[model samples]
Target: MGNGTRLGRVRGLGSAHEGAGEWWKHKVSSGSNLLLTLWLMVSVALLPAYDFATIAGWIAQPLVAVPLILLVLSVTHHFRHGLQVVIEDYQHDESRFVLIVLLEYFTITVRVLAIFSILKIAFTTTGVAA
Candidate 1:
């Protein structure tokens, strides 16, 4: 016997049991993204100047760097999850697998580049030229 209605079974569709987890992850990332984005906007708004030195100095602070990193991670993960859903829904067969793998690689590359940029700025010595 199957877990769905007789009609559903006849139609060959069944519960995947995976959507709940993905939904929760999307909700959590969206919430974090909201808060962190607000923080980023306020922080930037309060800055005395938008010059490279000022921005770099601000990012170098541990307090700033940590949340910035969190924001980067949340945004990237959210992006990947959303795109994966779209690809899975719209694409078919082998192409779906290919698109998903490409999406994963693209998201990973972007996250790595973002985190690396943050770390490079955060750890660099003060008074360095841009």
Candidate 2:
């Protein structure tokens, strides 16, 4: 109702569907990913070897275990957001959209399962030491 022009008034206003909120979430997630990636690199360096037992030993340490678990969770969440954006953009047809949705769900499920498995392995190793 003020004297602002139509385009000027609408310039910064985002979609009604919460696109701005999603963008903010993406920024936060990306920041967390940056930190997590650094921790993951250090974790990999601490491993004695590529063998299962050696890797398990490294992961069982509280210093590595906790951050790796958090990294897994945060990275998966960030990846899901990216995949959703891609799905929204590149998927046009109804059938293709349905396929992309299914693929996204499957990807998320697999990622969560892998994270749980890694946590389980780490904790089991920790328990074995006690």
Q: What is the TM-score of each candidate against the true structure?
A: 0.81, 0.73
Model 1, which residues run further than 4 Å from truth?
A: 1-15, 127-130
Task: Provide the lowest-lDDT 10-residue window in model 1.
Answer: 8-17
lDDT of 1 by residue, 1-130 (tens): 5598988756545776788998999999999999999999999899888888988988988888899999999999999999998997897667887898999999999999999999999888486432
User: Whose TM-score is greatest here?
Assistant: 1
Q: What is the C-alpha RMSD of each candidate to the true structure, in Å?
A: 4.5, 6.5
TM-score for predicted model 1 compared with the true structure: 0.81
lDDT against the true structure, each candidate: 0.88, 0.73
After superposing all C-alphas onto the true structure, candidate 2 shows an RMSD in angstroms of 6.5
Which has the greatest lDDT?
1
**Which segments of model 2 are wrong by more than 4 Å?**
1-16, 126-130
lDDT per residue as tens, model 2, 68-112: 777777877777778778876776556555766787788679777
Instruction: Give the Cα error of residue 106 in candidate 2, in Å.
Output: 2.1
